[model samples]
Target: MIERLENVVTFLDKYIAWMFVLVAVILFILLYLTYQCCLKYCARNLSKRDKPRHYRSSTLQYIRFTQVVKTPPRLSTDSHYQTIPLPNY
Candidate 1:
């Protein structure tokens, strides 16, 4: 009975280490994917450095997707600023 209990404990310890390694690998993969997404976004917006028209369009698309609206000032003296309204829901 003592030998069997020791074997069970050893097995549990080994599998716990393996579980930790698996979780670490999954976290690394997710981090890498997020990094790739950031790189793609930056490339799209900045690839048209020489062309203002394309750059602006790309920026506008990003802004639209992010739900950022540029609200014009109601008064002549008011400043122009971007606004992201909160969702009612």
Candidate 2:
């Protein structure tokens, strides 16, 4: 089992190294950009500065799914044994 784990780790080490390298490169780029923007802010280079230097990017978007909204499920209760809902009037 230890040998198998070592073999798996060795195999995954290459992929993990590359992943870390990619993440490091991306972080370095972002940090450099932020540094440059900070320098510009300190130097007062721009004429108008309404917006922020770094814009936060969204990772996910809110979306509405019709299937989840339009349908209703049935359920049973121990006392009533039938699900009851108010009329949608």
Candidate 3:
């Protein structure tokens, strides 16, 4: 009975180790495929371009300012003002 138990434990340990290795290999394959896909996508997009135009200026001109006339403020009559009581919190 003890020998059978030891063999079973040994078998289980080997099985568990293989399972871990299989999982690691699968994850590595998936990550590599994802990386390759992203590289291909970036290469395809970067290769085609509508090239943007850049305009260069030789000299800067002085900005013109427009003068605005000030208008006089009208005084408000006392009847237009009102006071409200604040609510207690």
Candidate 4:
């Protein structure tokens, strides 16, 4: 058991630098994606901070009018989650 452990440790020691680089790249991608998502959500939520226009009607709207154009979902997760629209028979 000790010999097997030593061999595993030796293999990792040889590849430690590669593992570190791979982990760093994955973490950077995840952090960048999270930052982008947050920025999108914030931009969508934030409203005007400056002066109002001559008419506020253009700037103001009711919540009921918000519409999102969602793309079609994949086959697997779609079955588990929301039901996807089907073509007419």
Q: Rank the candidates by TM-score, best first.
A: 1, 3, 4, 2
Cα lDDT of candidate 3 equals 0.59
User: Tens-digit lDDT track for model 4 on 1-89?
Assistant: 99999999999887997899999999999999999999987775564332234323553332212211144544676357655454322
What C-alpha lDDT does candidate 1 achieve relative to the native structure?
A: 0.70
| Ranking, lDDT, top scorer first | 1, 4, 2, 3
Which residue pairs overlap in candidate 2's backbone?
none
- Which pairs clash in the backbone of model 3? none
Quick one: RMSD of model 2? 22.2
Question: Which residue runs of candidate 4 sit more than 4 Å off their true CA positions?
Answer: 1-10, 48-89
* lDDT per residue as tens, model 3, 16-77: 99999999999999999999999998887764332222211211211110011123334456
Better of 3 and 4 by lDDT: 4
Residue pairs that clash (backbone atoms under 3 angstroms), model 1: none
Question: Candidate 2, residues 1-89: lDDT per residue as tens digits?
Answer: 99999999998998899999999999999999999999988767452342233321221211122233334745765564645353331
Residue lDDT tens for model 1, 1-89: 99999999999999999999999999999999999999999898776553445336676564553453344323434556534454232
Residue 85 of model 2, lDDT score: 50
Worst 10 residues of 2 by lDDT: 55-64
Clashes of each: 0, 0, 0, 0
Q: Which residues of candidate 1, in runs, are more than 4 Å off?
A: 47-89
Q: Highest lDDT, which number?
A: 1
Could you tell me every candidate's TM-score relative to the true structure? 0.51, 0.39, 0.50, 0.41
